[model samples]
Target: MSITERLSRGFVIFDGGLGTMLHSRGLSAGVLPETWNITHPEIVTEVHREYVRSGAEVVSANTFGANRLKYGAKAGEFCLENIIRAGICCAKAAVGDTGALVALDVGPLGKVVGWPGGVGFEEAVGYFSETIRIGAEAGADFVLVETMNDIYELKAAVLAAKEACDLPVVATVVFDASGRMMSGSNPAAVVALLEGLGVAALGMNCSLGPEQMKNILPEMQKYASVPVVVQPNAGMPHLEDRKTVYDVSPAEYATHMREMARAGARGLGGCCGTTPEYIRKLVGALEGITPRPITEKKLTMISSATHALVIGEQPLLVGERINPTGKKWIKEALLAGEYSEIAEEGALQADAGADILDVNAGLPGIDEAEALKTIITELQMITKLPLQIDTSDPAAMEAALRVCCGVPLINSVSGKTESLSAILPLAKKYGGVLVGLTLDDDGIPTDVAGRLRVAEKIISEAQKHGIDPKNIVIDPLAMSVCADPDAALTTLKTVATLSASGKRTLLGISNVSFGLPMRDSLNASFFTMALFAGLSVAIVNPNSAELQKAYRAYLALSGLDENFSEYIDFAARRAAGGEAAS
Candidate 1:
């Protein structure tokens, strides 16, 4: 059976760390393991055979650091290509007729991708694509992108693997004991983005041993829709007699491996300090265990480079005052290239209880692309809140999405064919949560059902391009309640219907009160109604006391603000004429 088919059957076993074994065989520190594939092919084959004897169902090639970025220039001609070819050949020779699979091992580039003045997105893609191409040409059965920390680099590697060949791709990242990647992506955020990219499996590897992995397994199991892979180190490294040592023993490691399988890990392996004995015992320990059945998790979230803002836990308030619509000061600042002014606005909103700041630089005459990039880059440095990339220009959207430094929420794509075609690719490419406008080429739908149909059409189009519904937030076009008395009713009905169907819904709450008296009261009242209708997020002015009061009241009533602490605190501060509670 293929690797994907076997994953559904039961636990799939991968080999232990090659570096640990190589060190025992007199391999020096800091030397590339791929070099041994060429100089001592017999040693490489021997290591693979040991894993096969220990019952490793999948043997990873010793090519983790064999890319051109590392092996070229200083190395001789055909160094990278020859090393990868030999690595695959060594695994095949060792596992001949043993029913074991060979995985082309890929690792990170040792540098951050998409940082300011760092490796560009396509440059990083090219780096992994070249390595994947060599492995595919050398006839590997699977591609394992391991030890990834940055989500952007992970995206480039996965995209490269898919484009380079039609092999099953398994991705795992390094997480600290606190259960976050080095890039600040928590387990839920990583699962959402990686699953949206269509990886065959997702999990955590390295940094910690089996015991620490057990702590992170629940989070991965909670969000991962695909098979979960866990490849922890034998234990954290410590010094013993001037040498490195791992704390966990073979039997202890085996026991924890059993626990990991019980916690829903279908794919198990070892990282640093593990050897054939550990794998042998792990295989024996999991003999009668069954892997957890895959469950589809429909969590809606967006993130900055470090934090994920989960929607639907409570009503999320997206601060919508940063747009250059009627804000003369913001527009003038953008024209003058004064990003500190924009950053100040974002900082103020973050203090005022905004979960996300909506950033738009669509001035009439200026370069929207440059302005959006400038503002997004600076705003991220100022506030920890995730920014919503609000733009009508596809160029600006793509530019901002590429360099925005986190998983942003794209302000919109519409039901119009041109809009969907233009924006969905960027969303899919960059992995952003999309706000889909429920209107078509025929114009705004006056009735709730018509708007619902438009939403369905947009979702269908998005799926055709392989975008997940979890990454989509439907906006049912909040028309002005003053112009059409039934407009708010239609929008609220759409919100209630969509939310019940497991779709995330957002509403531009201020639009419902256009041209009305005491607009803040109208907006606040309608905002409360939308929350009752299960609205996941609202785009409104966070600076408005009326809207914030309504939000805090909903949270207290809905049991979101624990013990009504936020509500009571805000009430006391307001009565004392102190600064408002954010």
Candidate 2:
């Protein structure tokens, strides 16, 4: 059976930290452990055999720091491929025909992108590809990429694995005490991106022990559709008679490991400072415990560098004024390559109560691709609100998606063959909460059922390309009520249709009130109706007082707000002529 199949059966065991074990066996602190694959093959083989004997079902090869970029000039005469091959040879020898797998281990480049100390994304991808190719050729059954903190680097490594070999890949990231990765990816953000990228399994590893892992598991379990992996450190390191020791004993570690298993972790292992005894005890504690069944998470999450916004939990207002459709100043700024105006717009929208900022720099005079990259990078630096990469050009979309620090919401893909062919691959490759416009090659669907068919078609096509339906937010194409009096009703019915099928729905709510008198009142009323119809996200101008009041009222009426506080405050602020009273 494949590792994924075995994972579905029960908790699968992986070996513990190789670095600490090597340190006890006379390996120095700063020495690259991959060097020992060539220098001391017996010691490497012995470590693998000990883990197998201790009940480890997967023994990771001693190639954690084995990439060419870091070790190429440092390993003297031992080439990168030879060292990786040796590491795999030891793992294979130890496991023998016991059905235990040998996973070729890969670690971070210890580099950050666009910084003085980091390498480019493609460079990182090339380095990982070389090592992964070597490990696959050496007969490793799996590829385990661990200790990742940077999402971009993780993306590079994962892409390399999928490009280099057919091995099942499992990715584990290191999180801080604040329960976020180094690049500001929270558990939900990490899960949304990695699962979108199609890893066999995903989880947290290293930096924290079992207690912290327990706190972090709920977020992972909420978003992860795949088998969740949890390989935490035994405990924080402490000094004992000039020797480093972990605080958690094997029994205590196993106790918490059992709790994690019961909580829903199907893959269990250890990180720094753990040993064979840790795995042995963990396996014993979880001997008869069944793996938690995986469930589909109904969340529409989009993220920026520092935060994630889950659309369905509450009404999310996406600032739609960033597009240069009618904004003369914004259009001129985009044409002049002056993003200061664009940056100010983002800040203003964020201040006015927008949860996400919809970015579009598609002016006729500017290069949309370059404009998107610049705007995405700058806007993320200015505000914490996640961005909706709004564009019709595939090149602009791909460019923006690649540079975004977190999983953005790409707007959009449609049921049209040309659109699916162009955008679905980008969504799968770059990872996003892709917006599916409910229109096809034939044009905007005239009725609710037609729009629902297009939305369903978009979901079906996305899944065919390995993109999760949960990652898609459908837009039911709200036409102007002035043009067709029934358009508003049609959109609301379509929203209900998609919501009934467990799909998140978004709408440009203001479009419904176009060319109508008292536009704000019409827009706000239409928005309330859409909310009642299960609208997950509303792309609108947050500067409108009526819309903001409507949003606060909806929160209170839906019981999402506590004590009618938001509605009360909005009424007070409105009564005070939008002025704050100190």
Candidate 3:
């Protein structure tokens, strides 16, 4: 079966805590290196057999620190290829082709990459390349990059594995007690970066315990398009008899596993101090339980005038009409320095059921940053709908993001290097959500693939800066149908692609109807199409009844409304208030 298929049917159980298991088998950790697989193949194969007997569907080979860099000059003499091959051969022998997969475990190179620590990117990549090539040549089914802290180094490992072989790569990072990597890379940022690199799976391993892993799991799943894997330690380690002991029993470990699985883990296993009994109990606890698939196309975290509307568990329709781009009255008011009109427009959108309001004040002959600040301050006083700070000016975006309470989304960066370089640091500094436009300095792409390429580049760049993909919103530029008949469909395709990348999507919805007759009908139709294509947010006039209706219908149809109670109650309220004119 394909890896996807195996993962889809409940959690894939990987072997647990090899170091401890080896120690239990009378191997001295400080003296006998795991690389002895080349010299003493029988001893390595015994440990593999024990894990297999304990019900491990996948057993990792004993090549964790067998790389040339770790072993130095002895690596060439000891034969790294033979060591890796012997480990995998031992693992396969233990499983006996019972359909078990062998993973070649590659640990860190024990050096920081880029700045401060001095390991250059090219050198880091080279080290991983050699390790991956040796592992692949030894017939390992997958290369497991585990316990990474620095994202730059993780990127190096991923790129190397992709270049070295065709085997799937699973990249995992270890987070410290601070809920961020030792290098300050958070789970969301890790998922965004590694997923963009096309790793087979992304997750946390060898962290605190199931409880801490549970806390990080939701945040990780929020941005992950790929399956999430978790292998928490049995519990915090305690010293007894001059050896580390884990307090959580197999049953207790299984309890945590159930919780992690409920939080949306697709693959579950144990890290340090766990054994086959722990795996058995975990598999048993999850026997009859099926995890609910994450179906939300776009997940968003909102900060409203009253409360934040994070758009994963429910649908959040952020009204995008307060901007003065095409609206003549809005533009005229801004030009006239009439701030009240903009505030009233924002209030009107909230009254018309906007969950969040996107505020923009970009116009000729105006202090964009000052105008944005004034509008945001006034809007906060009038309505509780969260504000999406929409502006091309970094000064303006930063100005709004600083004083804005709660998490706010910045209008965007594009595929262009300058925008990413300039805006991403701001997004990271202020903890701001970002909207990445699917266009570069060369302008928007004309085809779905081109749009996806641009979107991928944006996602990749955002990840490099340690920004969460959950916080990055992708806007595939929506063009007008009067100019190109396929504009709407192409935009939809781009939205779908962005959703599949596990990033939220935003579009200026009314752009599809520009210079066209019966614009409202076109706008509504386009909104519905975008929703069907997984458009999470639309920059459109929320005051329009047709557009609002289209959004409501889309939410109900998407199953986000749950039993249609919200839609029915809304329709009923509109009818009772004589607002059912539509």
For residues 390-465, could you state the per-residue lDDT of candidate 2 as single tens digits? Answer: 9999999988887776778899998899999999999987788989998999999899889988988999999898
lDDT of 1 by residue, 1-582 (tens): 777888888899999999989888979888787889888889989999999999999999999988878876755644788888989999899989999999999999887786776786678888888889989899899899999988768877887887788888999999998988887778877776676567888888888999999999998788777899999999999999989999999999999999999988999989999999999999999988777788877777687766677777777889998888889998899889898898899999998889999999988889999898888868866787888999989999988876665678898999998999999998887778999998999999998889999999989999999887888999997889889999999999999999999889999999988898899999999999999999999999998989989998999999898989999987887777776444
Error of 3 at 368 (Å): 32
Candidate 1, clashing residue pairs?
none
Order of candidate numbers by lDDT, starting with the best: 1, 2, 3
C-alpha TM-scores of all predictions: 0.92, 0.92, 0.56
Candidate 1 local lDDT, residue 336:
90
Name the lDDT of candidate 2: 0.87
Alpha-carbon deviation at 5 in model 2, angstroms: 1.7
Q: Which candidate do you rate higher for lDDT, 2 or 3?
A: 2
Error of 2 at 190 (Å): 1.7
| Every candidate's lDDT | 0.87, 0.87, 0.77
Can you give the lDDT of residue 447 in candidate 2?
92
